[model samples]
Every structure is written in C-alpha cells, then in structure tokens.
Target: MAYDSIEDLLNNGGLKPGDVVSQRELMEKTGATLGAVREAIPRLEAEGLLITLPKRGLMVPSLDITFVRDAYQMRTMIEMTSVPFAIKHISKSVIAGWIDWHNSAIDHLDRGDEEVAQRLQRLDWDIHLQMVSAIGNALITNVYRVTSIKTRMVGQSRIRVTPANASRVIGEHLAFLNPLYAGDEVEATKALCQHIDNSLTLALGGTL
Candidate 1:
C-alpha cells in the first residue's frame, strides 16, 4: 500500500498534539490501507510533525519554539551570505520583477484581502530566494530551499496577515527591493541584512 497523505489527515483539526490515533482508527477514517498508514506515520515522525507512543500509536508533534528560532537563524545566515554574490549575478529584468511583486503585494494590502496578502508575503520572500538561486550555486540553492520549506511551515502555524502588519511588511520588502534593482551591492546587502534581522526578530518574538 502507498503511504497515506499526511496533509489529508491534518484536515479538520482532529489531530492534536500528543493525541494518539491508532492504526485501525486512521485506516477507518482515511480509507488508507494499513501498510500505507504505517509507512506515512514514521515519515511525519521523523520530520518532527508527528510522534508515536508505545501502545497509543501516532499523534501530531508539539510545537518547538527553540527549533523554530534556530531554523530561522540558520536560514538568515545562509541567505544573507548569498546576497552579495546574487547582486553581482542577478539580471535587471529579474530585479524589476521583484519590484513588481512588491508593488503588487502593496496593492493586495490596500485591498484588505488577508489570504491573498499572506500569499503575496510568501512570494516576497521568494524574491530573495530567486536572487540567491541566480548566483548559480546549485548546492547552496538546494540546501536553502529545504530549510525554506521548513521555515514556511513553522511560519504558517504562527503568523496571520493583518491589514496593518501587511502594509508594514510590504513597506519593508520595497526597502529591500529598491536597492537590489539599482544594483547597489552595498545597500542591497544592508537591505537584506535588515530584512532578515526583522524576520528573525519577529520569529524570536513568537510572532512568526
């Protein structure tokens, strides 16, 4: 049997931290075969998204704030170090696209659409990743992408987009994007540092 889709099980808020769900119960609810359910549980466990008890079976994992902070810190270092190189290699069109994205994000904020606003927020972050990847370091890009996904998951659990905060975030992103578009390597690096610093500050504050 194939592994059960973990995303499916996470629906409806039924799986709480430390609340175990036996294999039989999982199978009954998901219609997933026993073999599939068994295989998927361990994967989730290894990812720190789930845990298993000796007799009670598997449950969602508890949030670890320390791990979240450490993850953000690690990502900040990796992405920041990539910036100077990215500024050197990134294209004019690419930088312009980033500016466009930030401008569009601002529009979303003005409209007060929280879901779209949140999505635009993530895309704004991706602008930095795209810049990094353009440095043509496959190994660095791959490693950072893995950590990025983890950070995003942790962020989703903790952050919600409000109109006020979204507007502020859009402003912050433009501050970073403008320097990069002008090919101002020194200022671009500074902007990236500030952007990462603000994010680290928020993550440490448990505001994600």
Candidate 2:
C-alpha cells in the first residue's frame, strides 16, 4: 500500500525528480503510517526510486542528460532482448488486441477524450510489460520493472503528451506492433528500434 501510494505520487507529478522529502512529509502525502513509510524506504531505495541522504530527507533522482540516456539505454537493451522471445511466444490474438486498442486510442485522442488518452498511456506500458514478461526470466523482468519506473519518471518529468502529439505517440507504438502481429521479426525489430530512438529524441526535447 505504501509503495502504491509512492508510485501514485510519482505518476501524478506529486513527487518529482530532485525533490527532497522527509519521512513525515511522505507519510502525510501518501496517507501511509509512519511505520509503513519506513518499511517501504529500503525497497524504494533498492529499486532506484529513492536515495537516502546522511542527514537530509530522501531524495528523488534528478533528471539529467546522463540519467535519461542510461535509463533509455537499459530499456532498449532489455526490451530488444525480449523481442525474439515475444515474437515466438506471444499470441497473435493478443497482438491484434493491442493493435485494436492503439487504433481506438488514436480516434479517442482525436476527439479529445482525455480519459481514453490516460488509458492509452497505461496500455502502452502494459504492452511493453507483456513483451518483456514473455522472456520468462524473473530476474530480467524484475530489472525491467525498475528500469521502467525510472524511464517513466523521466518521461513524465520531461515529456507532455498533448493532443497534437498523441496520435504520433500511438502511431509510434503501431510501428512495431503491426510487424510483430504479422510475425515479421526483422521488421518488428527495426521498427521497435526506430520507435525507441524517436522516443528518446522526444524525451531529450528534440536535441538528440
């Protein structure tokens, strides 16, 4: 419960990168007991979500060029490694379902349905999680989970998915999903690489 509250804060922009927060502040914001907050600290630190200072409060990771690069690189490595396994193991029906969701999401975003847009964001993460989980390695999945949280933090802090760019975002997802659904490993890999590169470019504010 405490972990969930922390994640909620992170996702909702209540907690941002480089924010130093005390335990009592965390307890108040998350509505978790003092003991619960303390217990969750070690796990949060272990996952790279929090850093303990000598005397100051816990600090969220700062968003820097290096941090963004490393986070995305780790994401690319883990996700690319899972592509082959995902291609072989993931069902065509599941891929089709995702494709359908993306298509619908594009329409909803066009109509300015922010609720659908939010759901689309969750779906985007789910697609990646499903792909990675297909690798069947608990350790890799666990590592990916941490990497994903960091990547998400960077994205949330740096990128804003407005209606103008929402379609492009969904389109990027389809770039790989289409090929994967068709069972074309080479095309899927190429498209996935391009998509990640595009995402990184956007995350860097189009500088890189």
Candidate 3:
C-alpha cells in the first residue's frame, strides 16, 4: 500500500523526478503510518525509484539522458531475453486475445474514452510483464518489475499520448502480435525489438 501510494504520486504528477520531501510529508500525503512509510523507503531506494539525501529528504530519481537510456536499455535486454520463452510457451489464443484487446483499446481511445485509455496503458505493461513471466524465473521477473516501474516513470514524465499517437502505439503492438500469432519466431523477435526501440525513442521525447 505504501509503495503503491508513492507510485501513485509519481504517476499522477503529485511528485516528480528530483523532488524532495520529508518523511512526515510522505506519511501525510500517502496516508500511511510513519513506520510503514519508513519500511517502504528502503525497497523503493533499492529499486532506484528514489534515494535519500544526507539531510534534505527522499528524492525521486532525476530524468537525465543517461538515466532514461540505461532504464530502457535494461528493459530491452530483459525483454529480449524473454522473447524465446514467450514465443515457445505462450499460447496462440493468448496472442490473439492481446491483439483483440489492442484493437478494442484503439477504438475506445478513438471515442475519447479516458478510462479505456488508462486501462490500455495498464494492458500495455501487462503484455510485456506476461512475456517476461513466461520465462518462469522469479528473480528475473522481480528485476523486470523494478525495471518496468522505472521505464514507466520515464515514459510518463516524457510522453504525452494523443489519439494519433495512441493509435500508432496500438499499431506497433499489432506489428509484433500478428507475427507471434502466426508462430513466426524470426519475425516476432524482429518486430518486438522494433517496438521496444520505438518506445525507447518516445520515452526519450523523440517522435515515432
């Protein structure tokens, strides 16, 4: 709960990268007990989500170029490693379902449904998370979870999704999903790499 509250602050722009706040302030803002907030701090710091300054307060990570690049690079490495396992083990039905969800999400976004847009973002992460989990390694999955959070933070700080770009994003998802559904290992891997590269560019404030 405490960790989620802090993530909510970051995602909602209540807290930003490089912002510092005292322990009491965090407790108040998150509505968590001081002890709970304190307990959550070390985990967050370990994940590179935030850090403690000598006497200043807890500071969120600054979104510098190197930071963004490293986060996405780590993401690419972990995800690319998962691709073989995902392609081999993930069901065709599941891939089809994902393709359907992306298509539906695009339609909802076209209608200006903010709720669906938010859900679509979650689904985007879920798809990647599912791929990583397909490897069946708890340790790597845990590491990927932390990387995902950092990547999402970078993306939220930099990318603003408009209808035009949202459709484009879904299209990118389809680019890989269709090949995966067809059991084309080579094509799937290539398309997934391209999609991740596109995402990295967007996270770094580049256009598609």
Candidate 4:
C-alpha cells in the first residue's frame, strides 16, 4: 500500500503483456526496499499478477486460454446464480453506486492507454463485487470474493478497453442494472448470464 507497485503500473502504463520484472527493477522504480518488494511480490503472485521462472526473475504472469475459460466458467456460475438473491437484498443506493463506478470506467475508455483502461476495468469489477455484497448473502459473497481474484488474474489479460469492448462491458453493466432497478429478478439473471459469457469469450483468446 505504501509503495507504488500497482499504482505505478496503472499511472504510467508501464506493465505490458509478457513483460518480466526483477526485484532490482521494481526497487529502482518503486523506491521500495527489498523487504517491501519481497512481501508485495507474493501477494501479487497469489492474485496471478506475478509469475516466477526457475532461474529467471519475477515477471507478469502469462495468460492461458484454458485458464480464461475456466475462470469465466466459474464466474458465470457464481454471478448468474447470485442475481436473484442480489435482486432481493441489494439496496437502491448500492446499485446507484455501481452505476456511477461503471460510468467512470466508461469515461476512461478513450484514454489510448490499454493498461490504464484495463486497470479501470478491473476496478469496476471490484466495485461490482462490492455491490453484490449488499445482497447480504454471506455464503455467496464469500465464494465470489475468493473466485474473483482468479477471474481477475485471467480476465485482466484480455481487457484492452477499446471503444467497442468498453462499450460492450458498459452495456452489459446496464443490462444487469436495469432489471435490478425494476425489481425484475428474471431479467437481471439474463443480463448476468450475457455479461459473464461475453467476458469469458473476450478473455479466452487474449490471455497472456
């Protein structure tokens, strides 16, 4: 939190697909001590944000098509099924907050920096999870919180945030929201399905 590992990557768009980074480089850039860098690496590694080589230094994890597929499979299962429960329990204010976060991500869609856009997309997903938590279903929310990191690890690879993809994602968010706003559980579930399926497809080819 103190250092600028993720923030640096987001701010300057320094990280890229298949880019490898060593402790020395991280230290130089982040101005973090070796211990701090060491501690941070594992956290990122756990999130699939970092990868290690046998004799090589730490690098960005490679994306795999299988990982993408499976991650989406799990995500779709969790999110789609959670829709009815979320619709029942989530509050209007929470839904509004999600919409605002989704719109903020859309505003950055044309930033021309793919990495920054991807970071925003990831943050948007984070906000969505928070919204889901408002459903007050501890079991479902806990499962989602655990699986989401895996999904992020794989999904982050394919999120390029072009106008088209950004628009599509934003639209899906609306699709999920409209029904929720109307208190229509069925429509909300349908929208959730489309969103999860589309996310999986997008990530399948672009991982790593």
Candidate 5:
C-alpha cells in the first residue's frame, strides 16, 4: 500500500501513538512489502505521526501540547465557520439520524454498556464532519479532513477510557445537539465552541 493508504490503515487501528514500531513489524502488520513501508514512513513522519530519535529509530509520537493545541484550534475554526452553511444545507433527516444515534449512545452509556458507549464517542466526530460537508465547500471540507485525521490519531493513540471522561464527552455532544436541532445557529456555534474547549481540556491526558 502507499503512504496515504498506510496512513489510513494506521488511523483505522493499526498503530497507536507513542508505540515504538519497526519497519519489519509494520510490513507484517499492514501486509505491505518493505518497499511500501519505506515509502509510507517518510510521509507519516512529515505528518507529525512519526518521530525520529537517536538510538530509537522511529516512534509514533505521543499526544503532545503542540498537536493537542493545533487539533483543538483547527477543529474550532472549522466547526464555527461551517455552522451558517450547515444550518442552511443540512437536511432534517440527517439531523434526525444524528439525534437518534446520539440518544442511543446516551442510553447505552447510562446503562453501563461499555462497548457501545465507547463506540459512541465517534458520533461526536461524525456529526461535526457531516456539518462541515453540508456546507459544500470542497476546499474547506478537505482541509478540515486533515485536521480530523490528526485529531483522530491523537485521541486513538493517547486518550484513555474512563467513566468521568466518557460522561463528560457525552454531555458535551448533547449540549451541541439542542441548539442544532432548534436551528439556532448562534447558540449552536457557542455549544460547538464549548465542546471543542472541553475536548482540549480533556486531551490533557483526561485530567478534565
């Protein structure tokens, strides 16, 4: 596979942040040949996903202050700017589906369904991305995609699952949904910003 594909593979659950990885291990795990692994490494390195160090060839970089800061900042920018267009373009059915999924996630979390509750975290991501896409700006959508990938990588690599954090995450998403469904763009924007801020605080190793 190519580096872009490799990046997707890793993002799809192949590699974890801060994990020390080797060429051979990557080749085997990803089913890519040595050549493909070599090609992908440099690109991954450029993306801040990989870190080169003395005596330790390469490592999946840990979620550091820079990545965390940048991720939250870019995310906020995309979410806030996309709101006006999203309010205009996103169909009611799509909004309803998002609402249904989010409500299910809340129910699952309340019932202590760890597996579904954990997977529910992704709903927050999907809702925001869908909103951005509703704006119909290919340029902005694609740019936000890179931010999405980076954010996903950091969360997957570093964030941990805990009851308090999970509850807070659920609450944050729920906070955004009300204003969105009400078609109150201003309040929706505020909720989205608060959600990102909360996420930034949580990314500090879940201290929040």
Candidate 6:
C-alpha cells in the first residue's frame, strides 16, 4: 500500500510541486491504510521527493534548478555505468525483443488507438528501466530505481507532449539502440552520449 501510493504519484501525476498532502488524504485516495502510508513516508523523504513542513506536514517538492541539474547528472552517471554492463551482458534475444516491442508501439500509435498514451508510458518505463536492469548488477539496478523516482517526477512535470517531442524521443532511442543492435561499440558510445545530452537539454527547459 505504501509503495502503491508513491507509484500512483509517479504513474498518474496526482500531485504537483508545492502541493500539500496528508496521510489521511492518501488513504482516501489510494485505499491504503494509515499504517502503510506511515511506513512509506520515510522512503519518500529519503528520496527528496517530499519535504516535511513544520506546520503543514508534507509538501511535494517544487521544481528547482538544482534538482533539475542533479537529476540529469544522476541520469548520465547511471547510463554511463549501465552501458558497459549492458553491452557485455545483454543477450541478442533481449535486444531483438526490445526492437519488436518499440516498433510495435509505433505501429499502434499510428493506428489511432485509445491506449496510445498509456502504452507509450509503458514503453518509456520499459526502455529506461530495462536498459539499466539489463546490466544484471543488483547494486546498479537498485541505485537506478532511486534515481527513477526523481526523473519521473521532473519528466512528467516538464516534458512537453507533442508530435515533435514524440518523434524526437523515438529518434534518440532508436539511434542508441541501432548501434547496440549491430554490436558497434564506438557508434553505441556516440549514440548513448547523444541520447543523454539531448535528454539533459530537454530536462533543462529546451524544446525537443
């Protein structure tokens, strides 16, 4: 229940920066028990996603320059760390599966499906999270999970949703994947770095 509440915020964008929420409100919203919500608070606090107010209790963290920079820096570090492990350990089958999945998603988007938004959301997580997880390092995977909490928050709050933005995201991911698919280390390094550079720029208020 505790974890679900945080995921709700991540997946649904239920709360905004500066929004104040109480445990009781969370209970009403997510059907989580008071005890579960209580247990969850500390973890959220530890992630710096929320802060305690002396009189107001908990407040969602407002977006800030430092947080944006720190978030992207962490993302870059995670991507760099994962790349070698991913290159060394990611199986051919996994790479092919990812290509099929993403291409299928593009097809569905072209078909004007009602679930395109949710499907795209799933793809975003599948790609980003799976990229790190594929490295097969528990410590790296765990660290990435913590970083993901902030990235999701900032991304949902900042990234513009439009046809152009969508195309850019697809292009960048494919650029990164193509080299990896072909087992080209030098090209993969360039693509991976380019992806992070563009991503950091987008997170820094640049248009896609």
Name the top lDDT candidate.
Answer: 2
lDDT of 3 by residue, 17-49 (tens): 778999899999999999999999998988788
Model 4: per-residue lDDT, tens digit, 1-208?
5244654463334564467778878877777787888888776667456677767787765556676677667767767666766776777777777677667766566655466456656655665576567667787776666455545555554554555466676777788787887788888888778776766666666331
CA lDDT scores, all candidates in order: 0.66, 0.83, 0.81, 0.66, 0.71, 0.70
Candidate 3, overall lDDT?
A: 0.81
2 versus 3: better lDDT goes to? 2
TM-score of model 5 relative to the true fold? Answer: 0.74
Whole-structure CA lDDT of model 4: 0.66
Tens-place lDDT per residue, model 1, 1-208, is 3343454344224454446778878777777788787877766666565667777777665545686777777777777777777777777787788678767767767777778665765576567678768778888786666455455455553343466677767777778778877877778777777777776666556443
Sliding window of 10 residues with minimal summed lDDT for model 4: 2-11
lDDT of 2 by residue, 93-138 (tens): 9999999888877767878887776677677778888899999999
Q: After superposition, how far is residue 166 of candidate 3 from its true place, in Å?
A: 1.2
- In candidate 3, stretches whose alpha carbon ends up further than 4 angstroms from where it belongs are 160-162
Residue 16 lDDT in model 6?
65
Better of 2 and 6 by lDDT: 2
Q: Per model, how many backbone clashes are there?
A: 0, 0, 0, 1, 0, 0
Task: List the lowest-lDDT window of 10 residues for candidate 5.
Answer: 156-165
- Models 1 onward score TM values of 0.67, 0.89, 0.86, 0.68, 0.74, 0.84
Screening candidate 3 with a backbone cut-off below 3 angstroms (N, C-alpha, C), the clashing residue pairs are none
Q: Top model by TM-score, which number? A: 2
| Candidate 4 to truth, TM | 0.68
Model 2 clash pairs are none
- Greater lDDT among 3 and 5 belongs to 3
Reference-based TM-score, model 2:
0.89
